[model samples]
Target: MTEEREPGFQEPIEYEEECENCEVRVAAICQSCGMPMNSAADYGGGNEDNNCCVHCCCEDGSLKSYEEVHQSMISLFMKTRGLDKERAEQAARDYMATMPAWIGR
Candidate 1:
Protein backbone atom coordinates (compact mmCIF):
# COMPACT_ATOMS: atom_id res chain seq x y z
CA MET A 1 0.00 0.00 0.00
CA THR A 2 1.22 3.51 -0.79
CA GLU A 3 1.53 5.90 2.13
CA GLU A 4 0.42 9.47 2.12
CA ARG A 5 2.81 12.37 2.57
CA GLU A 6 2.01 15.95 3.48
CA PRO A 7 1.56 18.45 0.67
CA GLY A 8 4.80 19.66 -0.93
CA PHE A 9 6.79 16.80 0.58
CA GLN A 10 9.10 15.13 -1.93
CA GLU A 11 10.71 11.80 -1.32
CA PRO A 12 14.47 12.19 -1.00
CA ILE A 13 16.29 11.24 -4.18
CA GLU A 14 19.22 8.94 -3.55
CA TYR A 15 22.36 10.12 -5.28
CA GLU A 16 24.42 7.02 -4.68
CA GLU A 17 24.25 4.22 -7.26
CA GLU A 18 25.37 1.44 -4.93
CA CYS A 19 22.27 1.46 -2.79
CA GLU A 20 22.82 -2.13 -1.65
CA ASN A 21 26.19 -1.26 -0.13
CA CYS A 22 24.79 1.72 1.72
CA GLU A 23 23.41 0.96 5.15
CA VAL A 24 21.05 3.92 4.85
CA ARG A 25 19.62 5.68 1.82
CA VAL A 26 21.87 8.63 1.11
CA ALA A 27 19.92 11.69 0.02
CA ALA A 28 21.39 14.53 -1.96
CA ILE A 29 22.44 16.91 0.79
CA CYS A 30 24.52 20.04 0.89
CA GLN A 31 28.12 19.12 1.66
CA SER A 32 28.57 22.37 3.55
CA CYS A 33 25.40 22.76 5.63
CA GLY A 34 23.75 19.32 5.46
CA MET A 35 20.57 20.79 3.96
CA PRO A 36 18.58 18.26 1.94
CA MET A 37 18.69 19.04 -1.77
CA ASN A 38 15.14 18.18 -2.73
CA SER A 39 15.10 20.09 -6.01
CA ALA A 40 17.46 21.67 -8.55
CA ALA A 41 16.90 25.05 -6.92
CA ASP A 42 18.18 23.65 -3.65
CA TYR A 43 21.55 22.78 -5.18
CA GLY A 44 24.46 25.09 -5.75
CA GLY A 45 24.36 26.76 -9.16
CA GLY A 46 20.89 25.24 -9.56
CA ASN A 47 22.75 22.11 -10.66
CA GLU A 48 21.64 18.82 -9.21
CA ASP A 49 25.22 17.47 -9.51
CA ASN A 50 26.56 20.14 -7.17
CA ASN A 51 27.39 18.83 -3.75
CA CYS A 52 26.64 22.02 -1.85
CA CYS A 53 23.58 24.26 -1.62
CA VAL A 54 23.01 27.67 -3.22
CA HIS A 55 23.63 29.38 0.10
CA CYS A 56 27.07 27.78 0.36
CA CYS A 57 28.18 28.64 -3.15
CA CYS A 58 29.76 31.78 -4.53
CA GLU A 59 28.36 33.68 -7.50
CA ASP A 60 30.82 31.81 -9.69
CA GLY A 61 29.54 28.43 -8.40
CA SER A 62 32.60 27.72 -6.27
CA LEU A 63 32.19 26.68 -2.69
CA LYS A 64 32.64 29.48 -0.16
CA SER A 65 35.54 29.47 2.25
CA TYR A 66 35.18 27.70 5.58
CA GLU A 67 35.30 30.95 7.53
CA GLU A 68 32.61 32.51 5.31
CA VAL A 69 30.23 29.58 5.73
CA HIS A 70 30.95 29.42 9.46
CA GLN A 71 30.11 33.09 9.93
CA SER A 72 26.94 32.77 7.87
CA MET A 73 25.71 29.80 9.90
CA ILE A 74 26.44 31.62 13.13
CA SER A 75 24.54 34.68 11.99
CA LEU A 76 21.59 32.60 10.85
CA PHE A 77 21.36 30.87 14.19
CA MET A 78 21.65 34.14 16.07
CA LYS A 79 18.94 35.81 14.01
CA THR A 80 16.52 32.90 13.78
CA ARG A 81 17.00 31.26 17.16
CA GLY A 82 17.76 34.38 19.20
CA LEU A 83 21.02 32.77 20.27
CA ASP A 84 23.86 34.89 21.63
CA LYS A 85 27.05 35.31 19.62
CA GLU A 86 28.98 32.78 21.68
CA ARG A 87 26.19 30.21 21.63
CA ALA A 88 25.57 30.72 17.96
CA GLU A 89 29.24 30.32 17.14
CA GLN A 90 29.42 27.13 19.15
CA ALA A 91 26.26 25.79 17.57
CA ALA A 92 27.55 26.55 14.10
CA ARG A 93 30.84 24.89 14.87
CA ASP A 94 29.18 21.78 16.19
CA TYR A 95 26.80 21.56 13.26
CA MET A 96 29.52 22.20 10.67
CA ALA A 97 31.68 19.50 12.19
CA THR A 98 29.20 16.91 10.93
CA MET A 99 28.92 18.36 7.43
CA PRO A 100 31.03 16.74 4.67
CA ALA A 101 32.77 20.01 3.78
CA TRP A 102 33.89 20.60 7.37
CA ILE A 103 34.19 17.03 8.56
CA GLY A 104 37.90 17.09 9.24
CA ARG A 105 38.28 20.74 10.14
Candidate 2:
Protein backbone atom coordinates (compact mmCIF):
# COMPACT_ATOMS: atom_id res chain seq x y z
CA MET A 1 0.00 0.00 0.00
CA THR A 2 1.19 3.55 -0.73
CA GLU A 3 2.06 5.68 2.24
CA GLU A 4 -0.04 8.73 3.10
CA ARG A 5 1.64 12.07 2.64
CA GLU A 6 1.75 14.80 5.25
CA PRO A 7 0.05 18.09 4.61
CA GLY A 8 2.10 21.28 4.17
CA PHE A 9 3.06 23.06 7.36
CA GLN A 10 2.47 26.68 8.29
CA GLU A 11 4.64 28.61 10.68
CA PRO A 12 3.22 29.06 14.14
CA ILE A 13 2.93 32.45 15.87
CA GLU A 14 5.97 33.43 17.83
CA TYR A 15 4.29 36.25 19.72
CA GLU A 16 0.97 35.45 21.31
CA GLU A 17 0.03 37.18 24.51
CA GLU A 18 -2.69 36.98 27.13
CA CYS A 19 -3.71 38.72 30.33
CA GLU A 20 -2.92 37.19 33.69
CA ASN A 21 -6.49 36.02 33.52
CA CYS A 22 -5.40 33.69 30.65
CA GLU A 23 -7.29 35.48 27.91
CA VAL A 24 -5.76 34.60 24.52
CA ARG A 25 -4.51 37.52 22.45
CA VAL A 26 -2.46 38.03 19.30
CA ALA A 27 -0.06 40.95 19.52
CA ALA A 28 -1.06 43.15 16.57
CA ILE A 29 2.24 44.81 15.75
CA CYS A 30 2.31 44.83 11.96
CA GLN A 31 4.88 47.58 11.67
CA SER A 32 1.96 48.90 9.64
CA CYS A 33 -1.15 48.43 11.77
CA GLY A 34 -1.06 48.46 15.55
CA MET A 35 -4.36 46.73 16.27
CA PRO A 36 -3.59 43.00 16.72
CA MET A 37 -6.41 40.45 16.60
CA ASN A 38 -7.31 38.25 19.52
CA SER A 39 -8.39 35.35 17.30
CA ALA A 40 -7.15 33.73 14.05
CA ALA A 41 -10.11 34.89 11.96
CA ASP A 42 -9.28 38.58 12.31
CA TYR A 43 -7.46 39.14 9.02
CA GLY A 44 -9.99 37.53 6.73
CA GLY A 45 -8.33 34.14 7.37
CA GLY A 46 -4.96 34.41 5.64
CA ASN A 47 -1.38 35.58 5.88
CA GLU A 48 -2.36 39.24 5.60
CA ASP A 49 -1.46 39.83 9.21
CA ASN A 50 1.10 37.02 9.64
CA ASN A 51 1.95 38.00 13.17
CA CYS A 52 -0.43 40.84 13.75
CA CYS A 53 -4.06 39.80 13.99
CA VAL A 54 -6.88 41.42 11.95
CA HIS A 55 -4.45 41.21 9.10
CA CYS A 56 -4.77 37.50 8.29
CA CYS A 57 -6.19 34.34 9.74
CA CYS A 58 -4.86 30.82 9.25
CA GLU A 59 -7.49 28.10 8.99
CA ASP A 60 -5.32 26.04 11.30
CA GLY A 61 -1.94 27.74 11.08
CA SER A 62 -1.14 25.51 8.11
CA LEU A 63 1.52 26.92 5.78
CA LYS A 64 -0.16 25.45 2.71
CA SER A 65 -2.26 28.63 2.77
CA TYR A 66 0.41 30.71 1.04
CA GLU A 67 -1.88 31.93 -1.72
CA GLU A 68 -4.32 33.25 0.79
CA VAL A 69 -1.38 34.91 2.49
CA HIS A 70 -0.32 36.75 -0.66
CA GLN A 71 -3.81 37.84 -1.66
CA SER A 72 -4.76 39.19 1.72
CA MET A 73 -1.75 41.40 2.52
CA ILE A 74 -0.31 42.47 -0.84
CA SER A 75 -2.52 45.48 -1.48
CA LEU A 76 -2.42 46.67 2.07
CA PHE A 77 1.37 46.84 2.15
CA MET A 78 1.65 48.93 -0.99
CA LYS A 79 -1.22 51.23 -0.09
CA THR A 80 -0.60 51.83 3.57
CA ARG A 81 3.22 51.60 3.73
CA GLY A 82 3.78 53.54 0.50
CA LEU A 83 5.82 50.64 -0.80
CA ASP A 84 6.19 49.98 -4.50
CA LYS A 85 3.43 47.73 -5.76
CA GLU A 86 5.74 44.92 -6.84
CA ARG A 87 8.40 45.20 -4.15
CA ALA A 88 5.95 45.55 -1.31
CA GLU A 89 4.18 42.44 -2.43
CA GLN A 90 7.40 40.51 -2.75
CA ALA A 91 8.54 41.59 0.68
CA ALA A 92 5.27 40.68 2.29
CA ARG A 93 5.38 37.30 0.66
CA ASP A 94 8.93 36.72 1.77
CA TYR A 95 8.13 37.66 5.34
CA MET A 96 5.22 35.30 5.47
CA ALA A 97 7.26 32.39 4.16
CA THR A 98 10.35 32.79 6.27
CA MET A 99 9.78 34.91 9.33
CA PRO A 100 7.30 33.63 11.85
CA ALA A 101 5.96 36.45 14.00
CA TRP A 102 7.48 37.01 17.43
CA ILE A 103 5.51 35.40 20.25
CA GLY A 104 5.38 36.97 23.70
CA ARG A 105 7.24 35.48 26.63
Candidate 3:
Protein backbone atom coordinates (compact mmCIF):
# COMPACT_ATOMS: atom_id res chain seq x y z
CA MET A 1 0.00 0.00 0.00
CA THR A 2 1.22 3.50 -0.83
CA GLU A 3 0.83 6.50 1.53
CA GLU A 4 -0.36 9.87 0.31
CA ARG A 5 1.21 13.17 1.36
CA GLU A 6 -0.81 16.08 2.73
CA PRO A 7 -1.79 18.83 0.28
CA GLY A 8 -0.91 21.91 2.31
CA PHE A 9 1.85 20.90 4.69
CA GLN A 10 4.86 23.01 3.84
CA GLU A 11 8.11 23.43 5.72
CA PRO A 12 8.78 26.82 7.24
CA ILE A 13 11.52 29.05 5.83
CA GLU A 14 14.35 29.80 8.24
CA TYR A 15 16.25 33.06 8.03
CA GLU A 16 19.67 33.81 9.48
CA GLU A 17 18.60 37.37 10.28
CA GLU A 18 15.66 38.65 12.31
CA CYS A 19 12.43 39.59 10.63
CA GLU A 20 12.41 43.17 9.27
CA ASN A 21 8.72 43.50 9.84
CA CYS A 22 7.69 44.24 13.45
CA GLU A 23 10.32 43.68 16.10
CA VAL A 24 13.62 43.54 14.27
CA ARG A 25 15.88 44.26 17.24
CA VAL A 26 16.42 41.51 19.79
CA ALA A 27 16.91 43.78 22.78
CA ALA A 28 13.70 45.81 22.58
CA ILE A 29 11.32 42.85 22.87
CA CYS A 30 10.98 41.05 26.21
CA GLN A 31 11.55 37.32 26.60
CA SER A 32 9.80 36.46 29.89
CA CYS A 33 6.71 38.26 28.65
CA GLY A 34 6.08 35.54 26.01
CA MET A 35 4.57 37.96 23.55
CA PRO A 36 4.83 37.70 19.79
CA MET A 37 7.80 39.58 18.27
CA ASN A 38 6.55 43.13 18.19
CA SER A 39 6.81 44.74 14.76
CA ALA A 40 9.59 47.32 15.04
CA ALA A 41 11.38 47.03 11.72
CA ASP A 42 8.30 48.20 9.84
CA TYR A 43 9.11 51.58 11.25
CA GLY A 44 12.42 51.87 9.25
CA GLY A 45 15.15 53.83 11.06
CA GLY A 46 16.72 51.66 13.73
CA ASN A 47 16.04 52.65 17.31
CA GLU A 48 16.92 51.58 20.84
CA ASP A 49 13.18 51.57 21.41
CA ASN A 50 10.86 48.63 20.61
CA ASN A 51 13.31 47.54 17.93
CA CYS A 52 10.89 48.91 15.41
CA CYS A 53 12.26 51.76 13.30
CA VAL A 54 12.41 55.44 14.01
CA HIS A 55 11.28 55.98 10.46
CA CYS A 56 8.07 53.97 10.38
CA CYS A 57 6.84 53.28 6.88
CA CYS A 58 3.22 52.68 7.61
CA GLU A 59 0.75 51.71 4.90
CA ASP A 60 -0.93 55.07 5.19
CA GLY A 61 1.01 57.98 3.72
CA SER A 62 2.03 60.18 6.65
CA LEU A 63 5.49 61.42 7.67
CA LYS A 64 5.39 61.81 11.43
CA SER A 65 7.18 59.89 14.19
CA TYR A 66 5.73 59.80 17.66
CA GLU A 67 8.06 57.12 18.95
CA GLU A 68 10.29 59.62 20.68
CA VAL A 69 7.68 62.32 20.90
CA HIS A 70 5.45 60.04 22.97
CA GLN A 71 8.10 57.90 24.57
CA SER A 72 7.67 59.46 28.01
CA MET A 73 3.89 59.34 27.75
CA ILE A 74 3.88 55.64 26.93
CA SER A 75 6.46 54.86 29.55
CA LEU A 76 4.07 55.94 32.26
CA PHE A 77 1.47 53.44 31.02
CA MET A 78 3.85 50.51 30.59
CA LYS A 79 2.69 47.39 32.40
CA THR A 80 6.25 46.61 33.45
CA ARG A 81 6.24 50.03 35.09
CA GLY A 82 3.46 49.24 37.56
CA LEU A 83 0.80 50.63 35.26
CA ASP A 84 -2.50 48.89 34.49
CA LYS A 85 -2.89 46.84 31.32
CA GLU A 86 -5.54 49.26 30.07
CA ARG A 87 -3.16 52.18 30.29
CA ALA A 88 -0.45 50.30 28.44
CA GLU A 89 -2.82 49.21 25.68
CA GLN A 90 -4.11 52.73 25.28
CA ALA A 91 -0.60 54.09 24.92
CA ALA A 92 0.34 51.42 22.42
CA ARG A 93 -2.63 52.35 20.28
CA ASP A 94 -1.78 56.02 20.41
CA TYR A 95 1.86 55.45 19.48
CA MET A 96 1.05 53.19 16.55
CA ALA A 97 -1.54 55.63 15.32
CA THR A 98 1.11 58.34 15.08
CA MET A 99 3.50 56.14 13.09
CA PRO A 100 4.50 57.79 9.85
CA ALA A 101 5.51 56.48 6.44
CA TRP A 102 9.26 56.10 6.37
CA ILE A 103 9.60 56.51 2.62
CA GLY A 104 13.37 56.58 2.17
CA ARG A 105 13.98 58.43 5.40
What does candidate 2 score in Cα RMSD to the true structure? 9.5
Instruction: Residues 40-78, candidate 2: write the lDDT tens digits.
Output: 465434454464444444355333344565665778688
- Per-residue alpha-carbon lDDT of candidate 1 for residues 1-105, written as tens digits (9 for 90 to 100): 998644433443566434776675456878788787777787888877788888999865689999999999999999999999999999999888877677668
Worst 10 residues of 2 by lDDT: 96-105
Better of 1 and 2 by TM-score: 1
Worst 10 residues of 3 by lDDT: 27-36
TM-score per prediction, in order, is 0.72, 0.41, 0.24
Q: Best TM-score goes to which candidate?
A: 1
Residue 93 of candidate 2: its Cα lDDT?
68
**C-alpha lDDT of all candidate models, in order:** 0.80, 0.51, 0.38
In candidate 3, position 10 carries an lDDT of 25
Q: Which stretches of candidate 1 lie over 4 Å from their true place?
A: 1-27
lDDT of 3 at 89: 61
Tell me the spans in candidate 2 whose CA falls farther than 4 Å from its real position. Answer: 1-35, 39-55, 58-64, 101-105
